[model samples]
Target: MARTNPLQFVQQVRSEVGKVSWPTRREVMLTTVMVFIMASLTAVFFALVDMAIRGGLRGVLSLFG
Candidate 1:
């Protein structure tokens, strides 16, 4: 493979970085909020599921004991 010099590498890096479409501040904030909301919902859903399983196990065990 061919190797580039340090200066060429830096130029290439800048060129690639310039081609990127950065997100606006509002877009970032909206996505961040959405992520937090989804995460909270997921956590609550799992917590409820865990409680149900735990309650079921306790009830079954109580019957045998």
Candidate 2:
């Protein structure tokens, strides 16, 4: 592998950073809110599934007990 000098590395990093399309504050906030909302929905979905499974297990066990 080739080694880059510290100055050259810094310049390359700056050039790459300049080429990035950064999101605006509003876009970032909206995306963050969407992520939280989706995460909460997913958690609720899993919780309901878990409850259903547990209830089914208890019902089956009660029949045998």
Best by TM-score: 1
- lDDT tens digits, residue span 1-65, model 2: 99999999999999999999999999999999999999999999999999999999999999999
Worst 10 residues of 1 by lDDT: 1-10
**Residue pairs with backbone overlap in model 1:** none
Give the alpha carbon lDDT tens digit for every residue of 4-51 in model 1. Answer: 999999999999999999999999999999999999999999999999
TM-score of 2: 0.89
Local distance difference test, each candidate: 1.00, 1.00
List candidate 2 segments past 4 Å from native.
Answer: none
Q: Clashes in candidate 2: how many?
A: 0
lDDT score, candidate 1: 1.00
The all-Cα superposition gives candidate 2 an RMSD in Å to the true structure of 1.2
